[model samples]
Target: MAARLLIGVLAVSGLGLALSLVAGTVLLRDYLYGRVAEQVSGLSQAPDVRPGAIAPSRLCEVTDAPAVLPSDFRLTVIEADGSVRCRVPGDQTGPPVPSVDELRDWADDDAAAVVRDDSGSWATSVDAFDQPGRDGGKGYVMVAISLRNADLTVQRVAVGGAAIGVVVLAVLALAGRMVIRIGLRPLTDVREAAREIRHGDLSARVPPGKPGTEVADLSTALNSMLEEIQRGFEKRRESEQRIRQFATDASHELRTPLTSIKGYAQLYAQMAARNTGSDAGTSIAREARKDVEQRRAEVVSRIDSEADRMSGIVEDLLLLARLDQQPELVKERVDLVEIAHDVLTAARAGHPERRLDLKVEGPVEVEGDPGRLQQVVANLVTNAIVHTPSAIVVAAATTDGVAVLEVRDDGPGMPAEVQHRIFDRFYRADVGRSRRSGGSGLGLSIVRALVEAHGGSLECVSSVARGSTFTVTLPRAS
Candidate 1:
């Protein structure tokens, strides 16, 4: 862009100089010749000389000459009948005057006027040498003037002027380029800062440059974005550490209770089995057996459910860690429609009571990690199944330029507040209900992370008592 601007300036400057020079030269040449012609005509009228014996008139040679610049062109005067009296180029070939077609073309064929000589250097005005005190009067005396070397001087000036113009233009263009670079240097800083950020240096920031340039504005914007990213990562790291610590603490706290319950239940079962032959012991053992069985079932269920919940949290943490380190490989394109079909098939097989409808759109394909994409779908589906445990409706659609994979359920949906935090780890809308249903709240968060890793987004649309819809939108590769 800078090169183009500089070249345009040079072109405009050259055009202007050439036009002005040509116009000024033509005007000056016309005016000078007009003045000389008028002066010569007056002199001829004053004194008439028209006889055979031509007498020399007292002509103003240097005195009548106009004030010419040092580099002005020279002129020579001669008779039309091929007799050279004075020469601009100093007639070397014995008195035959120089002839010029260009000068001849400008004047009428019969009309005598001051004209440029053949050498293109001289202008000549012929004033007839009228004999004042001689016979019969009205005779002609050819007044000749020469100016050949003067044209050479004028040409040298023009060439020098053009060369100086080119040198000045080149110097200005070079200086302008340097100024442009210095002004936009902040852009380079911003670009390098972004490069560092991509290399996992989240703290990298662009320094703002001096005022009033695009580069300064760009640097500010980049620094703002970096600040936001840095804050988000700091919060995420802190949350991850807390989650890991919480999981460990929960495991330790629950372990002792689980062991005691299982041991007591097992001991009671043995007692019931051994005392079946005795009346008192058998009656006591029979009641103890019922209590023990109830306790045992409850303890096993809690342990199993809690362990499963903890395991999901750990898996989610691992996935986030992997995502932080490096996203999944998008080495190959995957047919999104094909993966949607598999998810639908699984849903149909698993939930026979619920209607799982799969509507595949046209050739839905994306450039992403297939494994990650499928996992994103499965997570949404699982969320739909749990929320709207029955009547699952799985559908796929592509609109405009994006592919949307949805897992919808026809059960009661969540409120606005609950829905917002649904994706946050372990954030259950109904704590008691989630506990009863054996749910760990890391499912949707994991789904969000996985979907984002595939360069996709997740959204939910739900209303009171109405069905909830989870949609995954990804860019379809064309």
Candidate 2:
């Protein structure tokens, strides 16, 4: 761009210089011609060049021409009768005289004239000089000066103009380059920042540019967008990590009950095979039958128990997957108070040793799937019962447009960090307790999912040794 600008400027300058040279040369030529004409007009009035009275050769002697003129000047005398005489006829390089027709034309008009011939250009002036004898006779004087000096002067001016124009163009090009560099500096910084970002450096930012300029606004906007993208990228990475961990935990939990059931089934098959062995004595067969029947009953019972545990784990996993993929639950107005009561009753039956309390100040109703809502309450109550030996309290109330429910426990509370991840899939506050008590570690995670699917949110507040409270807030049905 700088180069183009410089070229444009030089082009215009060259054109201007050419025009100036032509104009200056033309004007100078005219001025020199006028000066020569004036000198000729003055010398024509001299008394020495009077009509027929002076002989042609004597005219040059009387005029004192060399004293009054430049070295290059030449004079021509024309008599009234049409004869021509030259002062410097022997100087072949001198200026030429006017033609015969030119002299005749000058005689009739008696005015100054300019004529051109093979020799050079001449400035001529003619007027009637005083007649010396007879009727006044017509005479003429023509003075010619060569234009060589003016041509030389114009040539010198052109060369100087060219040199000056080159200097001016050079200076302009350098200045233009400096200005462009300064203007593009901000953009250069932006380009470098973008390159860094491309290489995974989201923290890179362009330095501030001139305020109120387009470049400044662009930089600010770009930085803001990069910050948001970096934040999102970090969040996504965390989510991916959690998902991977969830899968591993889920596999481990499912494997435990399956392993138990497989062991029980294998034991039953071994016992039955031993009891079926061929025996010769009836007494021995009878005795083996009694023992085998008793052992088979016990083994079957154990297998059924493991099967129940495995079934529960499978059901919980399916529900979670369903909630994640498609949470299109049947929405209806369900009473939170009713769900809380039912969940507490079920929990109390399953955990008879754990004390459970239910408090319903008022009937709190929300729009959600009743079955899923009940599951939410059940999961929370079960979670409380499994994790702690202390009393569990279930509460429900309504205020304004919100339905609130909480299941809290007076058991050993959790740390702040543990509380934060309690609702993550397959996360357990007490891993040892989860394994021993046959807890799937998905209860709270499923609770959160179900609540969120109903356009509600669940939060847990806990402190070490202070107990933990799990709160659910739902939009009340209007």
Candidate 3:
């Protein structure tokens, strides 16, 4: 690109120089000829010639003429009858002279003509040479000044001008190349940085040269993009680590239930074997069998409870996985107030010991999947009931084109540190309590995911000894 720029500049400069040279050369040639014509005309108008007896006029010799006339100027006298005469050394041929008709026209009209021939070029000036005190009676005097030297001068000037133009163009090309290289240095740096980045170096960046230029803007943008990419890569690695840990935790959790079931089954089998192999009296054997049957029933009940707990955890995990994939939801207008009321009624019925307060202004509808939306409300109410022993407040209202649902609890509030990760999957504020209470720790995470999938936002506000509040905001249907 730089080379192309230099070539373009040179081409334009060369064209302008060519035009200037031609105009200047023509002006110089015209001025030189004008000066020659003036001299020839002046010399011809002189009145110092004497006529001969036989010759019509015996013009003064060019060398013997007045000093005002140029030395190389050749003089010619033309009579009224179209005869030509000139005084010159017998050994040298005089230069080409103007024709008789040209001479007569000049003498009659007092005009001049520049004539050229093989011998050389001349500026011819003719004037009537009348005797003193006579009325236009004598012949005409014509003077020819050689233009060979003037032609040679013009040619030399043209050659010098062409050489100067060539030198100027060469200098311009060199200067242009240097300027272009300096101007485009930033681009070279950018290219090298880009190459490094392409090879997996996200930290590479172009150094911003001077500010307030295109290069500076590009550098800033590229650096910003690199920063974003690096952050995304770090986030992805963090997510992968979290997933691996989650898988391990899930396996450990599933194994606990399975292990309990297996232990109970083994105990039941051992008891049955003992009952079958009794070799005592009938009454003692019957009594031992009855005791063994009761113990076996308790073992089976424990196994059934563990299986239910495992099934709940598996179902919650599957729900979370499906939410992660962003499944399409039903797009229907649902009333948040109605959902909140229903959820509150269920929570109150299930946990009658806990006080549930529901405050709903009116119908606040939003476009969403009714089932998912109801699930969101249920999860929040359930999470509050399980975590806190205080009263649960469920509120729904419409404010500023948004449908707001909030579930607040005054139970043993969480710490500020725990509040940050409360919405993370499988994150439990009190792990031991959560496990004993059959809390899968995915309630808040699923609530947040469901809220967001409805084009809304969910946030948790909680502090130790202070009640926790979960607020969900969804855009109201237009």
Candidate 4:
């Protein structure tokens, strides 16, 4: 592209230079010819010299005869019969005089004509005069100047101008190429970045260009677009991973309950079959039947419990799906402090031995679905209670047009790595404990989703052995 542009620049410049040279040469040639013609015309008007004044057959040496005549001027006297009567500056010769027809043609128009011969080119003019002492006799005086110097001057100017134009064009081409390369450096960077991206380097970026230029703006815009694309790809990858994990977790969760239910059902069936074949009146058989009935009842209760647990997990999964799809909520102004008090009250009643405290700074009112908001608070409180066996504090306050709810516990805090995935669905800090305690690991995930759905944010700050604090911030009601 740069080469083509430079070529185009040179082409246009060369054309202009060529036209200028032609025009200048033509104008200079015309001016030079006009000066020569003026000199010839002036000389032709000089005083007429009679033929008797000069000796016949001897050149009339009029070198100093007239101050108006230049040294290179050639003067000639022509007779009516096309003969040279005299010559001026006698040593100047070989440019023979004009013929009678040419002299008559010049005499008729009172104009000058260019005459060329072996000596050189000349500007010649002629005028007719009446010859003294000759009846009905006419003669012509011809005046001329050489054009060698003028022609040489025009030639030198044309050649010099052409050479200068070529040098200037070459310089322009070199400079233009360098400038174009510098100007297009940003685009080269962008191309390299794109190549890297195509090779799977998502972090590549174009170098910035000169500020306020089109190239700079383009570079900035391209960098922004690349960033968005990279982010989109990363998000897609994370989502896929999460989806796979969710499926695996769901299958494992359902499998455990199903396995237990199936085992108990099979045991109950074996017990019933054995009891059906026994003697009803025998004491040993009656005792055996009574023990089997009790065992069967226990087995049936266990199966029902497992089924309920499985059903709860399924319900939680469906709720998450709905929330992920942006479920509609009944949003209204509600006091977060009131919600916090209720959640803490329930937590205290459930775990009466645990120390639970409620701190309300003000009536923290926010716009949100009351039921979902209550669930969000309950989940956070429950998560804290399950993980930490220390004093738990549930706080509510309002500041800066936002309502803040916090659940804090004085127990072993989570590590940074754990905190990062703490809110991921089915991610348990203690998997065995979580499962044994009937935790599906969806508490924090649901809490986060519910908070976000109400235009709120959830954040956790934790360090190993430093205790953890979960804070939820929602926009205050207007």
Question: If scored against the real structure, what TM-score would every candidate get?
Answer: 0.41, 0.76, 0.64, 0.80
Clashing pairs for model 3 are: none
Ranking by TM-score: 4, 2, 3, 1
- Model 2: weakest 10-residue lDDT segment is 88-97
How well is each residue in 188-238 modelled by candidate 3, as lDDT tens digits?
Answer: 888898899889887888898689988899888988988898899889988
Give the per-residue lDDT of model 4 (tens digit) for 117-219: 8877888888887766678687887778888888999999999999999898989888988988887788779889999999999999998778998888998
> Candidate 2's residue-wise lDDT over 1-478, tens digit each?
5457557766786687678767876787677667767776665555545445554435655545555354666666656665565453334344444456767666566445676667545666655443357377756565556555655666686677667767876786677667776877887888898899899998889898789999899889988888899899989999899889877887888787788888878988898788778473799788888888898899888888878887888898888889888657898889989888887777778878878999888889888899889988887877777678899899999876799998888788888788888877777756664566637677888888888888889998988887899999999999
List candidate 1 segments past 4 Å from native: 1-313
Residue 48, model 2: lDDT of 45
What lDDT does candidate 2 reach at residue 305?
Answer: 85
lDDT of 1 at 476: 78
Q: Which portions of model 3 show Cα errors greater than 4 Å? A: 45-56, 60-68, 76-94, 97-121, 124-142, 152-156, 159-307, 317-374, 388-404, 410-421, 424-438, 449-457, 473-478
Per-residue C-alpha lDDT of model 1 across residues 1-478, encoded as one tens digit per residue: 5567667767887788777766755565555555544544343233322233222332213232333111232333433443444433332221223344323432222223543544443333333333456564432333222333344444565676677777877787788778766655676677788799889999988887667867677778778888998999999997898679556544543454456556755765675565454455577767766665676667567657656655655677678678766564664788878887887788768876767777776778788888878888877777777666657767777788988888887788889998877776656676543345535566787788777877789998888788788888888777
Global lDDT scores for all candidate models? 0.62, 0.75, 0.80, 0.84
The positional error of residue 406 in candidate 4, measured at the CA in angstroms, is 2.8
lDDT of model 3 at position 327:
89
Each candidate's clash count: 17, 0, 0, 0
Looking at model 1, which ten-residue stretch has the lowest summed lDDT? 64-73
